[model samples]
Target: MSKKDKNSSNSRRDFMKTSATALAGFYIVPRHVLGGPGFIAPSDKLRVASVGVGGMGGGDVRGIYGTGKVDMIALCDVDDSRAKQSVEAHPKAKYYKDFRVMLENEENNIDAVSVSTPDHMHAVIAMMAMKMGKHVYVQKPMAHDIYEARMLTEAASKYKVVTQMGNQGSSGDGVRKMVEWYDAGLIGEATKVYSWTNRPVWPQGIPWPEKGQTPPKDLDWDLWLGTAPYKDYVENLVPFNWRGWWDYGTGALGDMACHIMEPPFRVLGLGYPKSAECSVGSVYVGEFQQGYFPESCPPSSHITLRFDRPGKEDLEFHWMDGGIQPTRPEELEANEQMGDGGNGVIIEGTKGKMMCSTYGINPQLLPTSKTKDINVPETLYRVPKGDQGHYANWVEACIGGYGSKEFDLLSSPFSVAGPLTESVLMGNLAIRSYDYRAPRKENQNQFDYPGRGIKLLWDGENMKITNFEPANQFVKRQYQGDYSL
Candidate 1:
């Protein structure tokens, strides 16, 4: 209503329209820099809009706002019930049920975007924001598919925007310390790595519900489905259980590997796996019948990924989920715990071994006694507040603008996260391919599962499976309806 307020609103609208038409390839400058002459200053807050604001997303909202240097300009979510807390927390922010509407209306008003939606929707939302020249902070497992991860990585570079993945562990001190010890030759050359988790605290390895229920009044089921195939609403599918499904979620591997496997990936400087193989647990529906559900992720799985190390022998990495764990090390005491009892990682080398829990916490040498005595120098810079600082790190970097000192020091920039995500998704790729079946040539009634009992050779540069032609379908999923990268 005030004269200054109206003028300020008009200026923002004008700038957004002009930028959309004329600044297609230009980097978005800091908001303070947009003010002419006497109005220029560096104290302006970084304005942010968030797409998902419940569960893990709510945590992201609070973390970024806690930085005291950001303005929560807008919020969007498909389910109002899930987003209640976030909407109430930031009453000043405009709220919308559709992200596309939120972005179109607020594009000029916000400086950055925080994408905390489900796995499948992450890529499309993040890509649209990057194309609009807004900095982005996407949650872990950067994308649902390897191709999406690669595209997001390339978009970050092309758009020249500051970017960070939501794997808080990437900014933690545990990983940095492990990096230092590995670099100091304390562990010699890491030859084998194992990471495990107790996940699927939700349902998996099951058939789609034979029945569908009416969606809740507050939930827009269609928008929530987004890129996933259209399906009738089912109970217990929203909020959290979706992680077990193949369409909307990436199962346990995508849900937790970004946090659990990050330490080894960072310590060893890993890239795409040269080959992948996997075996999955099965459920029985009757005395003689095994449950075959392609729509859902398997109940439990053990994935082996082979990574080539230039001149040295290939590194063997193993990932286990559904409460599975690796063999106990001889160096560890009989009574000692491995990986905090539930989730953990073990990096074995020629000389010694080291271990850590999820989020790279509580890193220790195999002997445990040697943990305190080792003398590896702390060479890597520790992010302030460690993992808890993840959100603030991105906020400060956005305020500092792309290519600034703050941006350069980001912990999980897409350049690092993209490769990490691709490696993580490879485990899922192998798992899905394990169930690929074909009809027998002689006996039409009998099926020959060709994808089973085989190692899929990978050509990382081309993002394709060199040996198994059918397995390549999982590389980049087909989008449903109008949703796309």
Candidate 2:
């Protein structure tokens, strides 16, 4: 797909007219420029750059490079050694220790950039790319905080740049089919959703390790810290464990919720919850605590969120973590195993139920009886055959054409906003209130916002918390000195 093919005739005409008006001397042509017989190729092959070259970033680089249609022109990472694979993968590409410098030096060479950086840096970097007229694909949770998410969304619309959030599950055919199933009343008006994860394999909550150990020779600690407030470079926080800390990441919810909670949030049109609060087990409060947080950042945790349905009265949704599955339905045989690990979502309706894993790609109906029966309603949309590769979907969108209404960020506000905010931030809230005493062993199942924590009325359109001033302030963080929001 190329820009010529991506925009329809009307869109191309509008773009050309806009471009011509913006640049007085440039002549705009609506005709597709040809590079081969009967072929109008991309204006030029997309020259791509990647930031944050370790872990998820490394995987993203591989995916984009595999397409063979893009030129992996630049790779950037604070840790030189961690960027080795990317450097090897695209031997001809330039390497940079800072993304800001890379953008400054190669502003005109790149067509798009993939941001696999931590949650905090997502908005800043993506905004820079969009301002430069380059398309952007950033990893999930979209932004570090609610304010940044709103800013990124607005910027994308303002610049009219092709944008994709790295909730790759959004591209799955199974997700779309599931939405169709809900629309056709298979699950019968999905009033409640439960999604959970078991993550943070890295050490967290444990006392910070001694700081005397030397930093890796290839690591630039200062650049890696970027806009985050200064703190000693502890060995425990680096390489991968930052997800558990509030200063750097949003814990397990931020790490996995975007993918797992996507299906229900989208299909059910679950807008913002009226109020959300967190409850946890065995964590103690501390003197330095500024908000509700888990006492010790436990390896395993659980959180539940409640919402008032638009016209449906009170509707509740619960999330459990630490490999804890919800009470198995009694209809199943006593010996049946509960859902576990990676991630899963359970939607319980007034009638029967439907459950699936993160991508919903290979979902299974409840009760083994349903699986064996041939009378199940035919799935509304046929699940697209074969792997509809995540990166391919984004790249295709970037090049123009082959778009999906169901998966587009703009098209699925409920899918993107509800889960993105609740999953990640709810964990943060739980961690903040970690010291709060739980009244029972199953606090997550019975946690109440109005009874204990500050109750907030969310105004999604204005991105404001209407009820509590303190809670509104909490939505946006104070930038470190010399760093701007």
Candidate 3:
């Protein structure tokens, strides 16, 4: 076996040992001796804390509450006004305005934490939680930048904590069924994928707003900035509209790519992409077009990503925003219409085609005949039934439920990160590059960045561009303070 393979195997074994001892209610020594970071043992009812308890965080809390195996012990958010209703809902739970203070004060009380902050704050909060021996469920896109994603993945391994990315779609019945069908060869070699979303209900591309409005009393503007460079709080940027901006949000792609692309990324084992480039239409270029663009960044954008699959030929994945969808495939039957609203994914295989949406839940398979075929696989992969439930699957596994057969942290690899993040970042780069110029309908060989559209090679281990320097630089971001991932 290769040295890397040997190291990975060693890490898994160490994680299992540390996890087993913790589940048995033993101190298990410092995990440093076990070649992995230590974790706290499973305690009664699993005391839980929540960071960023608004927006998606509230939904996450509801899901965890659905499990009935956790107690809502604490809640944290920079915006007190947004969290006020949640705090009232969970009258028994303590509340805090900063995550750092919540983590330190509630260390012994919190067995796990649900991190539902914006993309930028995810890595920092999650890393701190795992270091404190708390199980973590971080919302998707996973990290603001590539470096942070790699760091979180590494920390999950090192800390031997039960970790779940809050892409809830990952736990759905249809998503697992899609993976099973692909594994059973329902469709031969998926070479191309098309995923799109109609997002940014908030304004886009508008120039930055003038400094006029006073900050809300319930909001702590400075704490909300966290690790990101400071900017004055504006009504356009806060509450729930940050996704359209450059600094705090990742636009439409970051908002929905994790849900739309989850199936294809999981089934094909498509790891990091080789390179990505983007082009967009002009309606969104103007500074004040329909007042959509936040005074901070572009209003609407489109991007196309070209990825090179190792040991296989190159693949092209296209993404569109502002209600754009792929040209209907000729092979699709008349009944197979791409539905309206939200996000969906269309995968074109050598043999046939498949499309799934609503985050792959209750998906519809096409060729109509394929749906009625009896020879097709019947047994779909399902998460095992348990007292802890689906949201707690990773946590239960950490407590040594099934020995070596338990869910391995590495089972779901970082394949989703490279392509998904690339697509999202491409939108940001395009808005910055072309200033949201007239949308380029035709695919071009050369993007403004030399070799931007060219097929490049990726070394996942080293997280480097074997061929393209510009693309490599795109993967790494400048850290603002002590935050280095």
Candidate 4:
């Protein structure tokens, strides 16, 4: 190895040795010698570094730090203005603009990483941390694409690292209750599931800006772009609104499905989808004039996915976004609210049905009255503090090390979240394919959307579309410059 590489490796080794001694040196002493039997030494706490410390990322930092078992050692974000709150809140944390630099310099000081970056950057940052043997807690959906999700899942095992996806609903009691109900046969065999959300609260189905503007002084536009293809800075793109664009975000499905669909996904033991098809709402510029904005996600969409179970028939799953919703179940009362009024889920079985709002909150059986009538023993373990315990779950697991009991209790480990994320991104694949345009064989001027009006068969193990080669583009995207899995 080169001299610099050797020296860096040596430094990391020395730091790790020192940290190990500090963490365990007192273990040899009696309980009373350390003040009390239940006392936790300061060195025993998990040290964490956060990336993209703004917006939802900031919330993640607070959740993890609030556990009181973690030390916020480092913070990183491309936008200083956006990260101001987190920076001021954790004044002791060493801050950096680029996560790459922070991870490189603080590799031995921190035991874990919290990645709350944009969808495109999640995989790259989390993958790097895992490769360095640092535990990782990544925001949902776990990755930007199916391939990245798969890789992150595999890396977690290969690296023997503790991992969790930021889908707090996985730890919610509502989902646990649903799981127990399904196991007790209250809902029978679920044949279909419907999930919807009134998302894209951000802009979507619109054309890209015609011109560029200078970025805010505190923002590092290039770093914010990360793995996405180069684009000139535009106003209102920072802090929010990136969700509508294909390059930096995964659209509405990516933003909400992890929380809304996770309950059913966990309750049903769902795997990769067998097939996917979708229809998108269009934007109209004038009377009878359709606006083609391929760069942005559609304003609305309804996606149908099929999954094959071992003994039963295929299960059909429907996803609706952009204020769209499934047909209200007759069992639901006319006056009662459905799925928190805006976002919710309904699992339909042969004999009955159950539903819940976002984050698996307020799960209920059909006929609302049946919710109280049917009671089943809780078979699944509930996470402490329910949904809010998600952060502490990861923190405790990191301190306990991989394969520990705490690690086994993680609600949304990469093993589970990876497949769930793949299922979520599968919807996006179909939606992007919906906008696929190719020249007609007979006419050079006309175009046809081949991806529409047909179902795309998927090979989950291979991560490919067996029926159409064109749709495979969405399975994995080209990483611009040095950014890659």
Candidate 5:
């Protein structure tokens, strides 16, 4: 464009990169021109923006905008082909392939951002926006690694920006009901919990595609790679299927555990795990031996985590993927579904077991009829519209400003979500640890899986694996290119 616009683009990066307080003056205009945060003329709307407007991210934007509560100011995605639909739908919103540039140029115009990128890129993108004092609503897992999760959890309050993770079930009435049930001791202090999902439903337990593909002209390959290692474009890795790879995705646990396990986290008021162990499915590449795919996640895994409680012994939590299910609790009717067909959660207490389907949508106590027989007074405020109101909840929270009741009332703000995501991903770490490989010094042609089948102890406050030193490296990955968090 014009000379003025070109200069703005060049300096936009630095402008948004600066501290939030330094950028506050630029936002006074929305007030000066339209009045303050409370001034809603039916013309006023939350100035919403997004990083990834393809896949589930597109759904996030559509839902928020569907509320007719926000102005779709800008959209950013590295792949134009993936973003085509959103661009067409929000034609008036400016577009960019790089989020940094979008933030630079649109910081003054954007009040909040939805970060719905790949699991690896979530924390960095959200951190940048939050540092600039923009509220953030990020998709689940909140972060790809434990370190990133901890940082984002802390950044939310330090920046004083409204934040929510896109684990919609966090707002669902079912989870709140479970919380109420647990509070009334209906389950008699949950000691063990299990959550499982049927996923990878994408590919896993395989080597990367041996050959590279021609990068589509519309896709900015480098920008799409973002914090991931620079590699030649691989076929079928984009649009989806990245979930099975470690560099970009958090595997099935990251993909679905947030929805499946959120209830237990809330019900028990859980914290970081003290130790984790896992067993994974194997891929038979030959007649005799199993293949080890370090770059890719295992096809399935069963991970167990123990969390120490104050007065009690500890909470044991189990996570399973790839359709694996825990033993059927004896209390349930044989015909009753275990975990909503292929996906579900179960909490076992001293007195009984409680179960639910995915996203904590359905809650039924074992022996089938306890839900109605034992009623606990509602203590928690229910999110309006249940899970469907998740998007609007953040929209209103952003409008109310951080520290307001709406902000404090968020169901999955980073404060709560970050720890929850970290706890969920700890399972992945144990899974990954089971597959950790090292080149054998004595035999150059072969590798060794030294981390397998070990109960890796964790030191949560420090974000370390105290018992398994080799697995500690996965806690925080080194960023390629210029990105850092």
Candidate 6:
């Protein structure tokens, strides 16, 4: 190895050794003792811990274990009931409800962490883990806001940690195929993209519950509200309904766009949107009146974002949710499924168009026959097991340690997921702005949505809305109490 390479390697080893000694009080197991007949050394096995092991979090923990190359060292979650399965499954693993406690105590033993919490807590949990020299695999949207995403993306490089976002489609072959096809000129110069989802399947567009139900006996309501402003426990907000609330969720666009729109984002080499505009659905309070719920996301929204491509022509991207869909392209066959029935994306260009369902699965060209006719070379490499390999890929990357080829090969590393998330949240900014209201001075009972009517201009670098001041508020949010980025 070159002298520089040797010095870097020694530096990393020295840091790990120094950190291990500093925390020996909490981590007493010897590396060699963890090795024995028919077993790899525990030091060699990537030691992984997880936060929020329920629902998708539960699935993430299992996926990482399924790789068989990692040691499950610890698990954390605010709700005891939700963490039951993971705790029962890993009998030897340490358990805790507070992530900060787990991290402080287990820092010497863990090589990486899986953050599968709600949207608002993602950045804080993952950022703290990354800062402590642990590789991180964080679930989608990356963060609750654009500014947080940008910060985590920059943090990934600064910390020199291996990182991956839980946008599994990023590891799928379909997206790679789309990228290669675009590079091959199969679709000419792309100019537009549309993505839609049938989501917010939970309650939205309603007022926050005025009264509190008794909090679940096994759940810590305040801890679950991490990073978001505190609120009295409401019925059905735990488990999954939180997606409808602005404080805890990023709405339907944040929940599904990462999976459905990733292929288009990857293929186009897109960046921040130059401007955004949106129209939202309204709930009826009476035959002639409409209800407004500022704390809840709209039931439906159609957002358009324009991008200034560096060398190519400007592009327009449309995002729809709450079962809204774009008009069918004339080139598609009448019988073909429109993006797996409930979720899908379509990219249009001068010569042709391409479409795919969530996770970038089932990709096909317009006319359907084009998929069979096209012979574009496979220039981009595919993950070993397509989307299923995403977990193992991150595990292996962590085992490869940081700065190795394996680390750099992660498909959805923060370097990429960060910007993708920021782009997706731009739509939410428009959706929220569509509902922004100030008291109408002439009428005390009514309000005017000053945030509407104009295209909200954006300055990506500065992370602000150049045209509308109120819309910029969604760019970054205030963290409550001890939680922060």
RMSD of 1: 10.0
Model 4, 1-485: lDDT tens per residue?
A: 22432343233222211221232332333324555322333347888999988999999989999999889999999999989999999999999999999999999798889999988899999999998888899998889989999999999989999899999988888988887788789988899999999998999988789799999999999999989989999999887899899998989999999999888887777777889999888877654335546678889989999987756799999999999999999998899899999999999999999999999999999989998887687655567798988898788777666765566677888878888899899998887774434444434222234675789999887899899887898889999888877
Candidate 3 lDDT, tens digit per residue, 1-485? 22453354334323312232332443334334444333333443667899988877888887776666678999999888788777888999999988889999999887788889888888899889988877777787778766677777778767766677766666566666666667667777788888887776776555566584667988888778777776778875777788766677776777777777766766565545545565544344443244333224444455665655555677777777767778877766666567334567877787777777756765545664565562555453355442124575655544432232344422232233434444455445434431233434444111243433444455555766566565555455665666644
Each model's lDDT: 0.84, 0.61, 0.63, 0.84, 0.82, 0.82
Give candidate 3 misplaced runs (Cα > 4 Å): 1-43, 284-302, 333-336, 339-342, 378-380, 384-390, 398-406, 409-460, 464-474, 479-485
* Model 2 spans with C-alpha error above 4 angstroms: 1-43, 207-213, 283-300, 340-342, 372-388, 401-423, 430-456, 466-468
Residue 284 of model 3, lDDT score: 48
- Whole-model lDDT, candidate 2? 0.61
What lDDT tens digits, residue by residue, belong to model 2 across residues 36-81? 2111134445678999877889998988777767888899998888
**lDDT-superior candidate, 3 or 5:** 5
RMSD of 3: 6.8
Q: Please, what are the lDDT tens digits per residue for candidate 6 over residues 251-326?
A: 9999999998888887776667788888888797654235657788989988898987655678999999999999
Candidate number with the higher TM-score (5 or 6): 5
The TM-score of predicted model 6 comes to 0.89
TM-score of each: 0.90, 0.79, 0.79, 0.89, 0.89, 0.89
Residue-level lDDT of model 5, residues 315-430, one tens digit each, is: 88999998899989888888888878899999999888888999898898887777678667776677779999999888877876776546656778887787788888898887
